[model samples]
Target: MLTTNRLRQQLAQKQTVFGLIASVPAPIMIEVIAYAGFDFVIIDMEHVMINPETVEHMIRVAEQSGITPLVRIAEINAKEILRVLDSGAMGIVIPQVEHKEQVEAVIQAAKYFPIGQRSMNSGRPGIFGRDDLADYMERANHEIMIIPMIETVQGVEQIDEILSVEGIDMILEGAADLSQSYGVPWQTEHTLVRQALDHIQQVATSRQIPYCAIPRQINQYEHWQNKGVHAFVLGDERGIAFRALQSKLAQFPVINTDRSQTEL
Candidate 1:
């Protein structure tokens, strides 16, 4: 049966919901993030090279674990979007959306008839073809989300137009890419980058659609919270795993080995 999009629910209620990028390419990791209490998880396809079957299993695991699963699609094309959605992703994050037309194209590719020209097919998301096609199409159109990424200066500048296109449920700030695009190169908090992000946030806020962002520095979270940002992607799985190991590694005493006749 179709269910409510919890991330959308959280955003609609203006609640601050937290999530992470599931980049580990393991269904267990997806389950673990949900068990860890994240409200949603983005199964990252743009960076990770997990095969199609694995992606479906991860989505199924997410459903089993009770986490809203969204996909960061490799590109803004019909085939990729449709396949991911058919695989049971509740939403999608399209990167480098620089113009209103791109956003419209994504909307066209994601939603069904009367809203978009997406090809019709039944899959896990449609309850494996058990649900009536008409009902599924109606619910799917209303439930699925198309979130555009604003990563470049051009995208930020076209923010108003992009958000103006209907069916875009949220906008994500690609901080790392935005920083690089602005020539700050890894300095996400650089003044210029901050200005662009602030403008994007301002536009989203005014439009009443949720704006999402990921914070690299743990301390930087409060700034978004203070700005009333309601949605957050809490960094990628590998980084989270690495930082966890790094923290644990810091706690143990260092091991030293020396081999010498006198020492022995």
Candidate 2:
């Protein structure tokens, strides 16, 4: 069912919020992420092969578990955006947005009549006709977030114009793709990539748009925090889980010794 966007509310309160990119397509993972105290979760459909049914289930779990669910759509397709929003995702994170027109298209697809020409339906987000239709449309327009990712050099160049779009709720920095766009390919820490990200943050700050940073390095979170950034998407769940598993195994010295001996 539709509810207040807790992530937006936290940002409005100037509270620092943390979230993770859920590459895993499971409702249980969404429940665990919410229970673990994350303010939001970007359910990745851009890279992960999660189907519409699974995506809807994950959103339902997120709602039940008390976390804002945001879906990262593969592109700026109206149908895809409409389907996910109808499934009750609180926000849509459009990937690789490089032009103001792209942002406009997202608005057209995601928002309602006076805002944009989003096709209307009293689906899950509308509480299946439980809520008044007029009231639901007004609430959906206000609560549903339209977030765009600035990943390419072209996107960084057009940062000002992109943020100038009326309905953009927030801006997210994609350091990995930004690095690749700069010809460094995964060198997200490269000086040039860092400079581009800094530029994005500076522009977003000047515009008073919340900039969501993905802290790839250990110290980067504190770095962004010190800079007064209120939102962060701490890497993906798969990497987090892998690291946790590796750390757990490292505690068993006997097992480590046996593995080393077997390799020898």
Q: Output the worst ten-in-a-row residue range by lDDT, candidate 2.
A: 253-262
Return the TM-score for each candidate structure. Answer: 0.95, 0.95
Q: Write the per-residue lDDT of candidate 1 for residues 176-208, one digit (tens) a residue.
A: 998999998999889999899989999999998
Q: How far is 16's C-alpha from truth in model 2 (Å)?
A: 0.7
Taking the tens digit of each residue's C-alpha lDDT, what string does model 2 give over 110-157? 989899988999888887888898899999999999999999999999
The alpha-carbon deviation from the true structure for residue 141 of candidate 2, after best TM-score superposition, in angstroms, is: 0.4
lDDT of 2 at 178: 91
Residues forming the 10-long window of minimal summed lDDT in candidate 1? 255-264
Where is model 2 more than 4 Å wrong at Cα? 254-264
Cα deviation of 160 in candidate 1 (Å)?
A: 1.0
Name the lDDT of candidate 2: 0.92
